[model samples]
Structure formats: structure tokens, C-alpha cells
Target chain A: MSDLSPVPASAVVRVDLPQQPYSIAIAAGLLDRLSVQFQDVGLTGKQVLLVSNPVVFKHYGDRAIAALEAANCKVTTAILPAGERYKTLRSVSKLYDVALKARLERSAVFLALGGGVIGDMTGFAAATWLRGVRVVQVPTSLLAMVDAAIGGKTGVNHPRGKNLIGAFHQPSAVAIDPDVLRTLPAREWRAGMAEVIKYGIIWDRELFERLEAAERLDRLRDVDADLLHHILTHSCRAKAEVVAKDEREGGLRAILNYGHTIGHAVESLTGYRSVNHGEAVAIGMVAAGRLAVKLELWNAEDCDRQTRSIEKAGLPTHIPLALDPDEILAALQADKKVKAGKVRFILPQHIGAVTIADSVPRDRLREVILGAMGNG
Target chain B: MSDLSPVPASAVVRVDLPQQPYSIAIAAGLLDRLSVQFQDVGLTGKQVLLVSNPVVFKHYGDRAIAALEAANCKVTTAILPAGERYKTLRSVSKLYDVALKARLERSAVFLALGGGVIGDMTGFAAATWLRGVRVVQVPTSLLAMVDAAIGGKTGVNHPRGKNLIGAFHQPSAVAIDPDVLRTLPAREWRAGMAEVIKYGIIWDRELFERLEAAERLDRLRDVDADLLHHILTHSCRAKAEVVAKDEREGGLRAILNYGHTIGHAVESLTGYRSVNHGEAVAIGMVAAGRLAVKLELWNAEDCDRQTRSIEKAGLPTHIPLALDPDEILAALQADKKVKAGKVRFILPQHIGAVTIADSVPRDRLREVILGAMGNG
Candidate 1:
């Protein structure tokens, strides 16, 4: 981690989808320069609806509105309730009301301003409102900036399952301001590292090694600016490259769901109360690593190395002791990715490489999950 | 008008979207061959959810289920209430429940078997189910068979407006069985002719002449079987060709909204109660024709010809007396096609062609709408 060279002023990663190509701009202090950025992306002189939650709005909503207005764009605001529980069709319905009240037209722009929940709901609103309009993502959390915001996978959860209802409506642009991390809660900042670590294990080896070289990975305040910039830019670039090749998750894009299979199961099993997304993904990655080792897809040394990285980021490396492994397995079977009645897993072959394996024996899955629980 | 000899075994109109190319099959007795057709489209041996309203299901559900089962596909049925009012997110939530209960995976197929309402809701469900799944539209109503079923536009109505929530998710296949029309209500069957007339006025002059040649265009039983098949095939082919050239309604496809600009407003102002979709579109086409004639964009002779054609089809050519002209204008301003505060209208240039006009003077619009109400 000794490379202390100054990062670029703003790193741009292009998501090259033929239908609606867009770019993610990673930079420091982008909120103030949002008007310029949006103008650069062809969003000026348009009707823009800025959607955010109360918490996020209190921090940055004014800046976003001012930026858009300064860009000569008409701006309207819809503030939704905060939390994962609020990410529902009901909430999205409220956004539609605001859009209609504001008279948002087909060419209007809906700017999502907040974390994954806000971005997902706003993007979905934009996707469905008037059968789909343009949406620009302004992710205010590390979790969203690196992962959720970059991809156009926008949706709200159903009572029965997570992301059971959604549309693959890509955003016109994704503008990330790293300065927002300073205000993000410590838990959310750590939750984001889980995804950054995920990029390392599945796609980028140098990123994996850098996390290992870092002295501390507990909070945003502890991480240097240069490393944070690199983490944000590299992770966005990796996700962009994968999504560009397979925009609809037809084949190559499923690799991005490396930890999400078990991770989503864990989140659902816990009723989304105990573990945040990043924490659940961290725990899922640990179990996936163990499963990879048990299936002889990867070595124990690589598994242990992955576990240490997860722990270093202050993320949970195991499932909660109270949760039943069988229930989790049931949830896994019901996951969207389950095909032909078989649960598919993206298992690591080594650092920075993984393979999608649906052939993992059911008995081995039970063993690895139970082992991750520290009991059998 | 005499070209239709036997109307091929099944006329196939390919919607050539590069990302997800699909076909719309128009046939006379295709309902009995549903299983074979679905299998031919790569839907065999998979989990299929057949969504239909109780009314349509009462007549066709058993056959569809039997056919799918015969093809060795696992089939689940979700019977919703029959009405445009029932097309809401809540109804879609019921479908999500059915999908989850059926354990529908990412590869599961959702087959819509009803009118436009059922097809729209079902397709919307398919679009959002696990981010997106394969959908086969089995349109029973003539309106759906000709217009709604051919386009990939799927949506549900919001309290604020009609079709305010939707996604552009193309179907894997659209199987139109003309035999089902025998059971369609007289009102719905007539409503569909408005769209057929629209295709004529916008792109097909021969089709317009064919309608003029028909003796009676009021009811399905009154129309000859050969002409009915031609209407279904020709209309589907026209829509497919337009959607193929512009899948997203970016430029060339806006012309498809010929009567929809004012038609949708009339539907919304009526609370979607007083007028069925085709009736409102019929009225809007009358008003649009008048507007075009008043603006000198189209001659009065062509406009009167269009009115006579709509009248011949048993469609209302005048706006409902109870609807306020101002309210209709306001609703038109709120339409999805309104760009930059201007309501874009697809005005006719002649019998078989139209042009997009956003510069229609407001006073002239008011005069034409009032004239259509027989008050000017």
C-alpha cells in the first residue's frame, strides 16, 4: 500500500451497454460540481426530479437541487422515508405521485440521491414512471457508490423475497462523491468494504493484495484518501467491465453474484434485521470460501486469506449462532439464481478468480454452512 | 382487399430487437396448438405460470393448462379479477405471490392469456419477476392481438394517470388465436378495431381501403372470417415492423402514438370508466384528424374519410358530451409523450401517413376538440 501517488481528479468508468450506454464518475467533492457533471452528460436544460430520504436529504438534497437548478434544469424533490423496510412498491408509488404532481415528462431526469435503498427505489420509479424515463444515480454511500449505483439493477423488495420485483433499467449516468463517505455511519462504511473485498476475490488480484497490505480496514476515517479513491475507481471499473459484457446477467454477469446467493439468503433468513447487506455478504463470502475448499475448487490457504481480509474490514465472517442452517438452506433453494431445482454457487478457484458451480453437493453445502456457524 | 386467400397456416411477424428478438404468431385455430407453438419457441420442459383474469380463464384456462401440461411443462395458474381497474401493483403483487409459491426461477415463463389488461399486467410481472423472465403473450382480445400484444410496452395504471407505471419488456412470443374472439364481449371486440383503424391511418392505406370495402364492421360475427384474419395478421405485421425499427420509441416509433396522445387523456379524464380504450382512441383520432385538417397539415377529405372509417367500425367518432374540453387538454398536457412542456401530437399527413407535431396552437386545439364535441 506504499503507492501514494495522487489519484486522478475524477475517474470515469464507462458501462458500454449498446441501448443506453453510461459512465460512472468517481471523484472527491463532486456534489458541488454536480451541475457541471450532469451538463457534461447531457442532462442540462431538462426537468429533473431529485429523490432522496429525509436523512440523506438533510445532508445533501439542497446541494443537489441547487446544482441542478444552476445547470438550468428544472428541479423537483420527493423525500421518502429511510431504511431497507421502506424500499417497497408503496414507497415507489409515492414517488410516482410526486413525479406526476411535478408534471415530470417522458424526457425528465430522475436523480437518486442516497444509499442503495434510495437509489433502487428512485431508479425503479424512473424506470416505470411513464413506462421509463432517464435516471441519474448520485450514490451517497460507499456500498452504493462501488456496487449498487454502477449497475442498472433497480428494484424494490417484496414481502416474500428480496428484489423479487425489479427492472434492468440502466441509468443515464452515475455520479459518485467520495466526500459523502465522511458522513456515512461507521457500520455502512464497513459494510461497503465487503463488496470491495468481493471485487478482489472474484476479479482483481492487485486489489486483493492492497487490502492485505493496508494496516487498518475498519472505517472510512482510517483509510487514506488515495487508497479510498483507488478502491472506489477500481471497484466501479471492474463492475462496469463485467456489466458491459453481459448487461442482462445472461452469462458472464452472474459472476457478480459471487457472495449474493448465500448472502441474500442470510439477509432474508434474518428478516433483514440483524445483518446489513455488506455484513451478510461478508459472512456469505466466508461460507462460500469454505465451500470452495471443501469441493477442492480452491486451497485452504486462499480461503483463510479471504477470511482474514473480511475480518480486517470489521465485517462478520460467520453466520449468527442463533440462526438455523436448514432455514438458510431453504432460502438458498428459493433464491432467484436457483435453476432446475439446483442451487448455484459462484466459488473461488483462487484469489481474483472464481467459477460458477451448481454441482456442489447438497451434503457438502450443509457441512460448510454448519461449519461456518462454528457447530455441526 | 381481395389479397387474403387463406392467410398462411400461421402468419409470423418477427419483432427484430437485437437483444431479445421475438415473434408474434397470428393464426385462425392456434389455441389447440398452444403447446406445440410454445415448445417450438424454446419454452418446453420449464416452469410456466399462466396468468389470466377469471372471465377469460373461465373460457380458456383449462385448455391452456392442459396444453402446457401436455408439453411436459409445469404450469401454475393465477386468476385475477377482470377489469382495467384491477390492473394495479396490488394485482401484480398477487402474481408475485403466485410466482413465489410456484417456485418460479429466473428461467420461468409467464404466459398472459386474456385481453390487454391481463397481458399488460402479466408482462409487467414477467418484466420485474427476478429482474426479468421470459414472457409469452397470448392475447385474446382483438385490441391486444393487433396493438398491445405486439409492442413490448407493459404497465399498470396509477391513480394519477393511466399506464404511469410500466417497463419496456418484450415478450418471448405473442400467440394470437382468433378462435378466442368468438367469446369476446361486443364492446371489447369493437374497442380493438380503433387500433386497426389507427394502423391504417398511420401506415397502411390498403388496410384503410379494405375496411371501407367491408360491409359491416360492428361485431366479430358480422365481419367475414377472412377479413378478421387479415386484420389480425396485417395489424400485427405493421406494429412489428415499426417496433423493430425503433424498439424504444426514440424517434420513428412515436408515430405509433397517433391517437394515444388525446386518446389516453380522454381515458384518464373519464376515470377509465366511461370509455373503453378503443372508444377513447376512436374519439381522439376524430379530434386529431380535425386538428390536422385545421392546421392544413392534412386535407379535410382525408380527415372525413378517417371519421367515416371509425364510424363504420362502430367506434365513437365524437368526444363524450360529458367530458370537459379543458380537462381533456390538461390530461393531454400530462401525457407521457409531452416533451419540454409541449404536447407532441401524431397528426395525419394523409390517409396512410402521419407526422409528429408539437407546435399545434392551443386555441386551435380547443376549437377542434370543441368541434368534435359538436359545439363549435
Candidate 2:
């Protein structure tokens, strides 16, 4: 333990779920020290199944294996195809085949070493394989690092919906190496900034002000080191705190889905092609802000500030021009967020305060979406 | 709730899992009253996916649907192919498609209306669909009525193994109608007796003695009503108690895998053909008893009593002649119970008592297998 480099105290966020509490470690170059992080979290499994995508594996797969093997772990790699299209039960079934062939015992650990797609598939595979096995998330993408990986919401997308099949199987530990974000696509970086900006508007006003003061919020290279660290930690901390309060999205966790209701609908309506998760979330946040203002739930000035932050992050603040407004509304009904024929929306009352509104009028919602797309 | 006939208090076993406690209602004709049972169990979901096999669905599908519809549930049926071979992720994926098409919400209920295969697949589908939904197990076969349906151990089989892809998602309720056993194959009736006999040997000496006293145990018709009721309630009570104490099989739950260790190896070696689950368990119990006696943990007379009871039930008590003893030993290594390369065995200490043994001698196990096959 002494020979291994210690992770900074501030970099680790502990998610205190009642049944299965775990820590999320965020640091640069933490991927190379994956074994130490596993050990720190008390995961002593000798058999490790490292699940990743080809693109991420090409860059950090060898280092991840070397670190695991340093602790005498027997590592098996399953490199899935890179993209949301391949995230299905067929892919998870392939992991099950690999896991079964490798004779992975219940004590075996699953290490997810990629972005949200790989992390979700691997985690779902781990969740259902032998009922469940321990998983350690090594999220390389900013979106996964700050949000997806910390929440323990793992699943694959269905043809009709995204993340329609899943489980709330928490990982034993999460090791986030911000350094790997350097290789992420530029579009994804801006997409991830959308979530960072979301944390500011939903839970942390100080974090919002910090991002508002930044000169550039679009690219990883453009951001200063201090704010980057703050963005990662603060977002993760906010997610962790909410998840701890409501691990299954029963109550408090719904607030975390502030933009996801419409965001998911936009992603679905576009077939998840043009608008990625973060970009859709950005557009949804804009729509939600306008709806709040229109309904007198929040001030127009606050709504404008929210839109300006999304613009600064280079995220879309309007529905895609090609999609029909009615189709988006229909897609919203099919979303996982809907309950008993009512569309539940998370509308903000202030910069850092939001409330769940199940009775949001349909006409008002349609008008806000149309206005965002310049059709109102 | 008032108009429906009350379930006999003696027939219902409440599985008091800390987070998700539920009830198991075992009655003679409960299949026709499934809705009443669901309402009693607090499952008020309006959308239901009724999963069954061709055989069970042919017998009672309409009745089950009519019962749910009586309670205003919009039930959609998915009739999967019958048998263990079809218990794969592909089968589950089909259910996912049906669920998506039905637009089943998180508040939806998945009612499994067949044997272990249907129950397992439906429960697993419910466990993973939309992260999870409520599931009601209406197990038809005797094997399912007493064992599979009551426990929340839901899963599908991988090509290489049984129940490799699964989860521990407890059903909202388990409704076991003993009358469904009337259409069950005679072989299946005897197979379920094996589990009933198991409950006797492991937890209830009285139940074991009652089975020993039965004039005929090969078919459900020959078994007297009082003893049959005792078998259903007692077995479920034992299972529910064990699962409540150890929900995830941490310690106490492993006891439920008593004959399953060797039983699974035998089933896997033969490709789950010729010898069904209960028959294999019967043979495994004989091996475990002899091994316990050889190790001075149990008496020869008690071992003989167990073998005689298995014979009465018309179940195999010896390893098949075609399977190599060496291959059986190898298969045990791949069993889910293996940890740190050691195969864990649940051996009987006495009637109504058992203990887990991890350090059983390999040579002794081989000799027991050889002796059971008349090769010693």
C-alpha cells in the first residue's frame, strides 16, 4: 500500500448507498493505477474481466492490464464495438459468453474501461452475470466520469428507447482518469460540458458561477486545470449525494434528471444520431428553462443565464430542425420518466433549485419546445 | 379485496426480505384467483406482460389473463417455446421486444405463468427491463410450485451453463396453484417431490418422515391431500426463511444448494438431457449422503433412509453409466459454487440438518461417484 501512489483525498467521492456503498476516485492518470484503486476499495478478487471498446482499449488497455496483473490478477479482455448502436443485449450476451468461458467466479471483478457506452454494457453484464459480480468503473470520457459512472445506472438501449434494459448495480469502485479525456472526440467534450453546466444550474450555484467566469468551456485543452478538477469533483459529488439519498430514482434522484426527460425524448426522436446524450440534455435544459419562465416558476433572467451557459459550452439550445414537435411529444410519453400517463418534468425555480412537475400543461410544454426551435 | 375469496392463512408463506418482502400463496386452485392474490400483495400495476410456454399457456393462459383483466390490468401475453434449452438470453430479448411494443412502464407487472423456464426468463426480463418492474411468479409445474417460483433467483441459461446470466430480483408476489400440477407430467410430479424431500432432509424431519410413510410418491394423484399441502407450505416456508436470512446467498442461502453442487455437474455433463433437474438432485443427494457417511458426518442408516425415500419418489440415485467420473469432477470445478478453485459442497450432517464443506477430498468424491455407479 505504501509503494502505491495515494489518491488525493479531495479527488474521491464516497457514494453512501444503504446496501452497497462505494467510492469514486477522480484523478489524472488514475487508469495506470487501477489495481491500487481496486485494493483501496477492498476488492481483492483475483479474476478480472476488463470490458472496453476498441478505441479506448487501443490507448489504455495494456496499461490497465499491467496494473491489474501487478497485483497477480488474471485478466480477460472483451473489447466491444465502439458506439451506441452496438449497446444491446447481444453485446452483453457476448460478455456473458466470455465470462462463462473464462470461468469467472462470483468473486471475480469486472473492470469497465471506456466511456458511458462501454461502462453501461459492462456494468449491466456484471449486474446480471451470476446474479451480480463486483464492477470497477474506469470511465475515460468526461460524460461518464462526472455523471454516468458515479450513479450506478447501467443498461443497454432498446430499439424503442435508450437504457430501456438495465439494473441499479453499483460498482465497487470508480477510477476516473481525466487524462484520457485528451483523446476524446471534440464533439463529445462539448457534449460532456453540457452536463458540467447542468450540475451548476441544478445543484451547485458556485460551480455555475465558476463555469460562467471561464474563458472557454467547449474543449478540454481550453479549460484551466483548477476549474477542470472542480468540474469533475463537484459534478460527481452532486451526483453521489443525490444517488445516496435515492439510489433508485424514487424521489431525490429525480432532480438529477432535470433535463433528461426531454433530453431522452430528443435523443430518441433523432434516433440518437445527430444529438448525443449531452447535446440533447443541453437542448432539453434550454426548453426546461423557458418552460419554467413561461409558467412563472423561474425568472426570465435566470433562464437567459442558463441558455448563455449552454451556448458558451457549445451545446445546442434548441430542438433539431428536422424533427417534428409532435413526434418529440409522443417520444416523451415513451420515456422511462413518465408515470401513470403523466409526463414528469424537472423545472428549475432558481439557478440551483429544481422541482418535479408532473402536471405541466401539454400546450405550455409544446409551446416552449416550439419557441426553442423558433416555431412558436 | 372484499369480494375475492380469502387465501387460507396456512397456505401463504411471507418471504420477509428486508428491502422487498413478499408473500407466496399456495392453494389448490389459486391460478383462477391470481388477480385477487396480486391485489392482496399490493401489485396495482395496470400494464402486465404475461410470459408463459406453449404447454402451460395452452392449459391456463386465458384464465390467468382473465383474472388480471378482472382487476383492470391490460395484459399482453408472450408465449415462448417450452423447455430449458429455450431458457437463453435470446428468449429474454424477445420478451424485451414484447415489453417495448406493449410500452410497459416501470410500474408494470410481469406475471410468469409456466414452469421454472418461463418463470426464470420472465423474472429475469422483469428484473432487467426498465432497470426493474414488479414480477409475479405463477409456477405450474411441481418443481416450480415448491421451489423455483417462491425464490427470486431469476435468470436464463448460457450455452455453457445453467442460470449463468441472472439476477436476485424478488418478485412482488409468488402465486403457486397446486391444482396446476394435475396437467403436469408424471415425471415432473416426481421431480418436484425431490425438492419436497430435500426440504425434509435439510429442515424438517417431520416432513421427511411423512414422505417416508406415503404409500405411493411417484405421482401427485397418489399423494394424500394433507401431506401434499404440508409439502407445499413447509418447503416454501423453509425456502422463504433461508432467503430472508441470506438474500444474496452470502452464507445461509448456500445451504439451499445442498444437492445442487453435484446435481448441477451431472446435469451439465449430460447436457441437461435424459436426467432432469430433480432427478439429478436426487442422484446428487445420494452422493452427498454417502460422502458424509464416509467422512463420519452422517450415519449409514440415515444414508439408507434417504436413498429409500429417493427410490420411493422414482428418482435416480446413482450417476449415469455413460458419464465418466473424471468429467463429473472436472465439471464440479466449473460449477457456480466453486470459489478460489475449491468446489463447495453442502453435505448432510443429519436428518433436518446440513453443513457446507469446502475441503472434501477429491479422491473420496471420485470413489463415491464410482461406487454410486457400481464401479467401486
Candidate 1, after superposition: displacement of residue B81 in Å?
A: 1.0
In Å, residue A342's CA in model 1 sits off its true spot by: 0.6
Worst 10 residues of 1 chain A by lDDT: A1-10
What is the lDDT, from 0 to 100, of the residue B239 in candidate 2?
90
lDDT tens readout by residue for model 2, A44-75: 44799999998899999999999998777899
* Candidate 1 lDDT over residue span A267-365, tens digit each: 888788888999989988999998998889999999999999898999998888888999998998888888898999999998999999976799999
What TM-score does candidate 1 reach? 0.97
Off by over 4 Å in 2: A1-10, A374-376, B1-10, B374-376
Question: What would the TM-scores of all predictions be?
Answer: 0.97, 0.96
Q: Once model 2 is optimally superposed onto the true structure by TM-score, how far is the C-alpha of residue B1 displaced, in angstroms?
A: 24
TM-score of 2: 0.96
Model 2 over residues B1-376: C-alpha lDDT tens digits?
Answer: 1124454333778999888899998777788787788788666548999999988888899899888988788989999998888998889999999998888888899999998889999999999999999898888988888889876899988888889889988898888877788899999898888898898888889889988999989888888667778888888898999999999999989988878888998888888878899998998899999999999999999989999999999888988898998988998998887988898888898899999998898999888988877321
At residue B371, what lDDT does model 2 achieve? 89
Residue ranges of candidate 1 with Cα displaced over 4 Å: A1-9, A374-376, B1-9, B374-376
> Over the stretch B1-376, how does candidate 1's per-residue lDDT look in tens digits?
2455555446778888887888887776677688878788888888999999888999999888888888888999999998888889999989999999989998899999999999999999998999989899999999999988877999999887888899998998888888899999998888999999999999998888889899878898888777887787789888988999999899989988888888898888878887999998998899898889888999999888888888888888877788898998888788878877787899999888999997778899889888877421
